[model samples]
Target: MKNISLRAGRFLTLGLVLTGLGLGSCKKDDTTTVYGNWTQDASISAPRSESVSFVINNVAYVGTGRNPAALSTNNVYGDFYALDPSKTGSGWSSVTPMPAAAGVRYGAAAFAINNKGYVCGGYGYVGTSTNITYLSDVWEFDPATSTGSTVGSWRKVANSLPTPLSGAVAGSIGNVGFVGCGFDGTGNTNIFYQFDGTTWRTLTNTYPGQPRSGAMSFVVNNQLYVVGGTNNNVATTDVYAYSTTSGWALKHYLRNVSNSTESYDYSAVSRSLGVGFTVNDKGYIAVGGSTLTTCYEYNYADDTWTLKNPFNGSARNNAVAFGIGNYGYVGLGYTGATRLNDFYRFAPNDAQQ
Candidate 1:
């Protein structure tokens, strides 16, 4: 062989190229997969949705939902249950009910503030007729005492929004709670309001997604994400986010898939229903209808949507979900013509890629 001279920089460049290609190949082989499906952690003796759920100190408390009639009359259930996922024994046990039966309401909202849970808004039978009364009232529940008292009842706080509205999405970041985008009985709304324990103030800026009702919302990394809901039962895949300074920005559109079957009908016949929770800066949405057993997740860093494993329970919609640390709980809803009172939990290994 003839004598060959090699440049030092050229040799380093060749080494880097080979290393990069090898890493890229490894990443390409790492396909995303669903690790955990739904598991029956604890079954409530009674089932309810359109009710409220919140977690404090790794314990989940669920209460309130409509009865089987699909009518608000006799729909209110005051009884509550406490679930300890860490325990191996019977998961959920009965706790105190609300002092009085809450309004016969469905599609209400709930959040925890100062270790206390607050429940607000939903349809109820104030009279004999079904009315979309958005409750301005708020109730406080203490997990330590295992009791709830209506302390922060719907008082007119400073700069309160127009009229009481229901089907609105509510969530909290830090000490502030946000309520945005829903119906006022007659029409969809794009208004945004914030509550700081004592008062409510409307943000001048509004979200970009089409005004909708029954959408699900959660906060991660101090940013709020709102996903999937209906405009007259017209489900939408549009997702939006709000930050401290950046009011609202369109993130991505959710897509539905059936075991690798992809579809872009986010606004198809699916009903604008409820079921969402936050996990490790990501938000997961579960169960909504006109159809059931559907699930999806939103990644905040990339602003991308990924269809996850479908719920393994009865296919249904109009249910609610809450996250306690890494565990997710889903329960209660109308499954086509019938109403269901069952609940399930989803646990995924956060360490695995």
Candidate 2:
């Protein structure tokens, strides 16, 4: 009988051990599968935040932002630089600066249509730090006339936006550019307008989503996806898609709003001033609102969110991002009071870092 008892004890111990291993396997299966990779790239010419970036003729132009070193003096920049991704080493080259008559500004809206880049409304302190001036001027940059490394010239577009706005977002489809959703000093607005390479006209159709400021947009399959920003001083997770054919339709929110529990908590995706870009037909948002490094990717086909590797950079907001050829590039923003000039290239389907 004593020998029987000893055998029973051994069997019980083995059963418990196997059960524990099975539970451990289950936990491993539940672990989030992180995707995407980030590698440090050549930094921009200067550290800046609240800057404007647009791609013209497959070349990216970045310029016009606040100078962190002289924030007390309200120092803003009008200088522009062109970055060629195909080139090795620092890809940045100097270009003709934004015209001073347009006012050195930050938080301006920019878009490229038909190989011409346009800069729209922004606000500046004018002369005194306390006296702010909101502008409704539009400037166009044509690089075709440029020879080699020399960028082209800036000419003021005859028609300005109907109203002066800062923190607006703009995107272009073919020859038409769409501008919408920003703070007009007094309040947040939902108005959208279209520029047909000539005149700016208010679209009678309105976006069904909430009006937001500091939002970012990226185009995929010719559809513009507007994602993340603030509404009435509160960060929002709303995502909306707009096209000339469909007007507007609500898409998946930044967070996981489905009934299933498969998706990890993505509460961090709701923030303003994040950089948005499209890579391989997928839209991505990275680093914004109170110094964040988290990144999220949107699958346009699935209308779902996937967790990408967090940005491998100093936590920041108001940085700029643009896609050239196959990869997406992000750079230039402030961390606390310190401005950053570093850049990173993102590979969405690469092994997670």
lDDT top scorer? 2
For candidate 1, give the lDDT: 0.65
TM-score of 1: 0.77
Off by over 4 Å in 1: 1-32, 70-72, 125-134, 146-162, 255-271, 350-353
Q: Please, what are the lDDT tens digits per residue for candidate 1 over residues 260-308?
A: 3322333322336757887666787777765666565656775544555
Clashing pairs counted in every model: 0, 0
* Residue 116 in model 2: lDDT: 91
Quote the positional error of residue 268 for candidate 2 in Å.
3.3
Q: What is the lDDT of residue 20 in candidate 1?
A: 74
Superposed by TM-score, candidate 1 places the C-alpha of residue 11 at a distance from the truth, in angstroms, of: 34
Against the hidden true structure, what lDDT does model 2 obtain?
Answer: 0.79
lDDT on C-alpha atoms for all candidate structures: 0.65, 0.79
Q: Model 2 off-target regions past 4 Å? A: 1-28, 69-74, 125-131, 147-149, 256-266
